[model samples]
Target: MGTSNKPPKLLRMEDYPSWADKFETYVQALNYETWTAVEEEYIIPNNENGSNYRLSQIVEGDKDQFLREKKMLNLFQQAIKVENFQLLQHNGSCYSIWQALLNKDRGNPDMRKSKMSLLKKEFDIFTQVKGETFAQLVERYCHLVNEMKRLGIDKPDYEYIDKLANARPEEWGTFIMFQQSNPVAYARLNLARFIEKLEAHELELRKNHNMKSTAVP
Candidate 1:
């Protein structure tokens, strides 16, 4: 009976930790020592002349080199983002994904400034984008605020709340006015609490409106 000749499975994209837990196991299984070992026995190939070399002696040197390169390539591939895979796939260096992400984030000053400017514009015009739920809007708002803070543009908590209240629909005016009236309580409400209260108020208003509209004319 003929033996199966199936090649061993190569590390795949799924081996990355961003998606799964296989990368550590895979790395642990890759034995650098075994890869670098020399063979103890000599093999004579057919049609060879006087010189005979050990198969281990010939393959061991290349095996270490091959495994080292494979390990580096696998790490590099794992570090690359799926979105940037096409752009950076051709780059086969040994840099990690965190390094790549850092380099991208710490781009030239002009690029950083440009990104900051765009973020500021988005923040200035920031409202609940159409079809965005309250939670989604809060997430987007907080993201912009955090990004601006990272760029050293942090403002006061009240200022952020003021901006958020301004961005909210007119239906939120009652809550905004109530906040304005109760300065002490309002001051105690952090961004999260503020958003939660406003969202609850909006929901209550919606429920009341729905109930009224459904009543007899």
Candidate 2:
């Protein structure tokens, strides 16, 4: 058997397309503490006068600091951009480097507010695009809701259900019609049941359309 030469898939920050796209993946990779252990364990010691030396100026004699610096050097080499690499190079210690990276990548309060506003605006006018399946549309709608909640903009479950139902494409008209005929029951139904009922009706409508088309020819 021939050996494959493909690199192993390690979780690297640079793999994601953008900062927003990277947020969830990065959080999962580093967990809740976000590499704090690395920062604490790899401390840079002070000089004879008790003032710490800059990481870039650290000497070769201190094997531990040298190795720590080398690890940081490797991190910068694998960094997404030259600017990021340069920024990381200036850190006095691992903690400072970690803090800098976190601050640069994490969204602040104002940024979160702006993002929440935009997501809410889009959700308010949400619509299933043409040719989009019921499952796909529901998935998108649920994703938007999840993102909003993550940003601390929690909304009621009923509100989400209403918005999702209203935004559905015309192909889901049969489902809407059924809901209209039994408004009380529909209003009382849970999201899972709602999704199943809507998708079932959508499938029935497609089946009927196909049957009619075949009969016509």
Score every model by TM-score. 0.54, 0.52
Instruction: Give the true-structure RMSD of model 1.
Output: 11.8
- lDDT (0-100) at residue 156 of candidate 1? 72
Clashes of each: 0, 0
Q: Please give, for residues 92-120, the per-residue lDDT of candidate 1 as tens digits.
A: 33333323434445456898788788888
Instruction: Please write out the lDDT profile of model 2 over residues 142-200, one tens digit for every residue.
Output: 77876676567777666877787888766567667778688688678777787787778
Worst 10 residues of 1 by lDDT: 1-10
Pairs with steric clashes in candidate 1: none
| Alpha carbon deviation, residue 167, candidate 2 (Å) | 0.9
Best by TM-score: 1
| lDDT scores in order | 0.58, 0.61
- Name the runs in model 1 displaced over 4 angstroms: 1-76, 79-97, 128-136, 150-152
Best by lDDT: 2
